[model samples]
Target chain A: MAVASDTIAAPEHSAEGRSETIAFLIMTAVLIVAPFFIYPLFLMQALCFALFACAFNLLIGYVGLLSFGHALYFGWASYLAAHAAKVWGFPPELAILTGAATGAVLGLVAGSLAIRRQGIYFAMITLALAQMMFFFALQAKFTGGEDGIQGVPRGKLFGLIDLASNNTMYALVVVIFLACFLLILRIINSPFGEVLKAIRENEPRAISLGYKTDRYKLVAFVLSATLAGVAGGTKAIVFQIASLTDVHWTMSGEVVLMTLVGGLGTVFGPVAGAFVIIAMQNYLNALESWVTVIQGVIFVVCVLLFRRGIVGEIAHLLRIKL
Target chain B: MFEIFGIPSNALFSQLLIGLINGSFYALLSLGLAVIFGMLNIINFTHGAQYMMGAFMAFFLLQYAGLSYWWALIVAPVVVGLFGMIIERTMLQWLYKLDHLYGLLLTFGLALIIEGVFRNYFGSSGLPYAMPDSLRGGQNLGFMFLPNYRAWVVVASLVVCLGTWFVIERTRLGAYLRAATENPTLVRAFGINVPRMITLTYGFGVGLAALAGVMAAPIYNVSPQMGSDLIIVVFAVVVIGGMGSIMGAIVTGFGLGVIEGLTKVFFPEASNTVIFVIMAIVLLIRPAGLFGRTA
Candidate 1:
């Protein structure tokens, strides 16, 4: 009976896996072809946010940790990257690395403090810390205060390839997005990821099974932060600006909104969510606070009815993973 | 006036008074959060929004209904608390069965909607609420001047906080609340309406926040974003104090406010972050908090 159950589950799992791959392939193809039809600037912004959301999902979906202040990682990294490029005269690649490194360090400090608390306290702690950082950014001289470090030069990717043109920047963004997305996929499917899931499912049980759950959580947080930094850094370069908007509590909420709308645990959910949310904000720019109201309504509705999110629901209907 | 650490006595004393006033709001708000968390096992993210609502309620009453500050003091919290009860019934009750995070998310969403709507109508600017005729002007304490309205806020919030503490920690009703939190099923089996108690408890906690808001209108700007900003600091206060003890929340709230005020006098740049920094240190030194019992 056990063997029969195992055999039945194996093929279904494989089918889900195959569907996920197909979805990724299709998503990549759409992203590649998207710029020609849609505005490249919008697409790049969406892709950066998509990457940011994916990094955020790494912690929330897989680890069952809802960080209410991911904007700390994304926003600070953007500032650092822009500063590095514009002030220090670094190449784009080096500037982005600086941003990622900042994310890792901040993640270590934040993760250590935050992991001390469980559930709701964890969320609150993250938010408070992020707010602290927001104030710091507002006062810090290096951050340019309210104006932020603007007019960041889109230097060469590696001191060789010119990235001034929209097409080149778009290509570079797509590459970075794909690379990071795949890395996240690889991380989630690894032995490390299984333990993360184990910890998430039952931390005490994982401890009983001799897992140092905190270390795993910390590592996952760092990795997530690093990727978020990459996205933020790329955004700074592409947009030629890194401002308070990226680091604000609202930005953190926006990332959470994207993840919630996309499907918390689904692989493709954040990407789909990022695109939808970014598109809405772009189109609804005229409505001002109404956009906030609409986003809030979406949040309420998503929590109440569409908990599985866009991709999650579709995956469920198709009986496949996304 | 004498000097303390190169700062004049009057400057220091006035800042201390300002801190005390801010602390009063913190103490009240955190107290409400602790009560709600005790019963509901959820952090009331909408507490901030509700507080904002209370202030807006006071503003609306005074503007449209020709109500006085005294009338607002009595009326605003009840109205806002009733609204809180409606939310508890319609939205919050549904979330009790799921992960606690959903409660936070849902409340956060509600807060966003409320703040967004208010901002749309009122814009980001603050509206002034007039001080009651009963509590106007200031007093000279020889070293520093004391504003009567500010002093009243401190006293009122303190009375409410201590009164709440007495009821929760001393009364027979408090025992039932504690019992319900421990085991709702057991409490319900004993013929008590646990669900209604839970709803009422949430409403009461929210009312406490509204009361603080009504008090705050005279001191701070009656603006939509005020509550959200203050709520983050209150969350840090809750963290440092830990949620396990009611006294912890109260003490931490007031203590942090004083510390914040002191920081402003000394290291003005760090004033915004001193509480958060203390929270981090607290988490490191005593993960369970100063007064919290480790679960």
Candidate 2:
């Protein structure tokens, strides 16, 4: 499996690598400059969601596993991170790490159960598990029931740099986002990633070739969950609260919508998708359920006519790998 | 009345009854899901929303049309089922060639749209659906008091479930349906309208969900969010049952409901999640599910 992947992936990387680098550079420049003109808080929220969608895409886009209950990881991480910062008085960095750890642990448990069944059953299992967590969260005391963990102190980054100011926090979020983005790119381009793609393309063939596809899928699931946790934790810190809304299935659906709108398997799709969705949510805040309606419409449209999404279409038209 | 397991019999019996009622709905919903999945190869994420629509349809009938519960039992399913058929024809027909996940996503979107639109007009609060006069009273069993309505719900749902089972497993039309499920191309060559059959199958499945919703309206109240909450639990039940056979879906649905009810009595904290816990254990033991054959 390893040898076969190397031969196939090596040539594709050299050609695709240049385009990916350019896209990354362009995205970084946009992140750095856009806050000057737009609201930093919105940017922070959008980036957090972008990271979340990217993590989600790692499973669906690359691994071909559609998890319908990812809000479990993202939302639980937010809760634990908020709890750590508020109740435990941990530093911001440590709290975020705590959240990420929470996601990894939960992902390990849920992924094992979900991967037991393939295809549609996998989605259902994950969703059920996530819903289970949601009920647990509702009953758990530290979550404060419906009120959630509010007024979470965004403590210093390393017990040195004060992150009370929006500018400092935005900068911190951007750095973490960029670092995670690079790590994801690196993972996707690695040998392990090639095996993951192979599993996605043909699990039985990969298994016949001696690849333990389940292990690869489990590892990918955990990685995606951990990154999702980071995104959720960061959002909790930025928003200064983590509520039931984060853990709800709707949040899970929202992430799916973002990834779909961006492009399912494309490198730059989730980021664009996240930004578009967050902007829509921010602007449509006054309309209440209409936002959900609009989101549903977009989902229908994307699936029916625009399955490639914004970035996927662009990449296709230009004959480039996004 | 005698006590069992250190608990009052009345409390235990009452919880058990509630569990049976929940199980009835679970059986109905999961049966619909299984039937639809068999023919359409889609998960029908909008089943819950359609169920909600059925309850709302009943409410609308009572409020505006001066129709009674009896009328609603016949009307709601047809209306909601027609709506589902329209959706299947216009949207779901295109997704037959794609990955099954797309169907799930598309239906999920449809669910959100339906729920959102309902929420926009009705708000999130529950609308009351009155109990019919004939089914309003209760009966005193040897051990516990059973509401006539609750008993009727169990019996009606059981009959419906078994009837569906019989139709699919025994009838000639069901034979055609099963044959189509196995190989649609071959069924089409044999002069059956596979596409129309698929649409009707989807509609029939949706109608069953609506029927459950109609039955559930009096007990749970008609609300937009009702279907979403219940649907996830039904999903867990489906996972446990394996969606392999109709009987499996019905039995698992009722059995899990009873188990959940028992948990509520013995361990209240875990009551809400007992089904999911059961699902996890079932997956560990039989990945294809208890009733499902390994595919």
- Give the runs in model 2 whose Cα sits over 4 Å from its true position: A1-12
lDDT of 2 by residue, A1-322 (tens): 4666578867887878888898999999998998899999999999999999999999999999999999999999999999999999999999999999999999999999899899999999999999999999999999999899989999888889999999999999999999999999999988788888888899999999898999999999999999999999999999999999999999999999999999998889999999999999999889867998899899999999999999999999987788
**Candidate 2 chain B least-lDDT 10 residues:** B286-295
Give the C-alpha interface root-mean-square deviation per candidate: 0.9, 0.8
TM-score values for chain B across all models: 0.98, 0.99
Best by DockQ: 2
TM-score of each: 0.98, 0.98
* TM-score of chain B taken alone, candidate 2: 0.99
Candidate 2 per-residue lDDT, tens place, B1-295, comes to: 9999999999999999999999999999999999999999999999999999999999999999999999999999999999999999999999999999999999999999999999989999999999999998898988999999999999999999999999999999999999999999999999999999999999999999999999999999799989998999999999999888999999999999999999999999999999999999999988888899883
Model 1 Cα interface RMS deviation (Å): 0.9
lDDT of 1 by residue, B1-295 (tens): 7999999999999899889989998999999999999999889989999999899889999899999888888898898889999999988898889999999999899999999999999999999988888899899989889989988888888888889989988999998999999999999999999999998999899999998999999878899999998999999999889888888888888898899999999999999999999989999998877887872
lDDT of 1 by residue, A248-304 (tens): 999999999999999998899999999999999999999977998899999999988
Please give the TM-score that candidate 2 achieves against the real structure. Answer: 0.98
How displaced is residue B122 in candidate 2, in Å? 1.1
Please list all clashing residue pairs in model 2, or write none if there are none: none
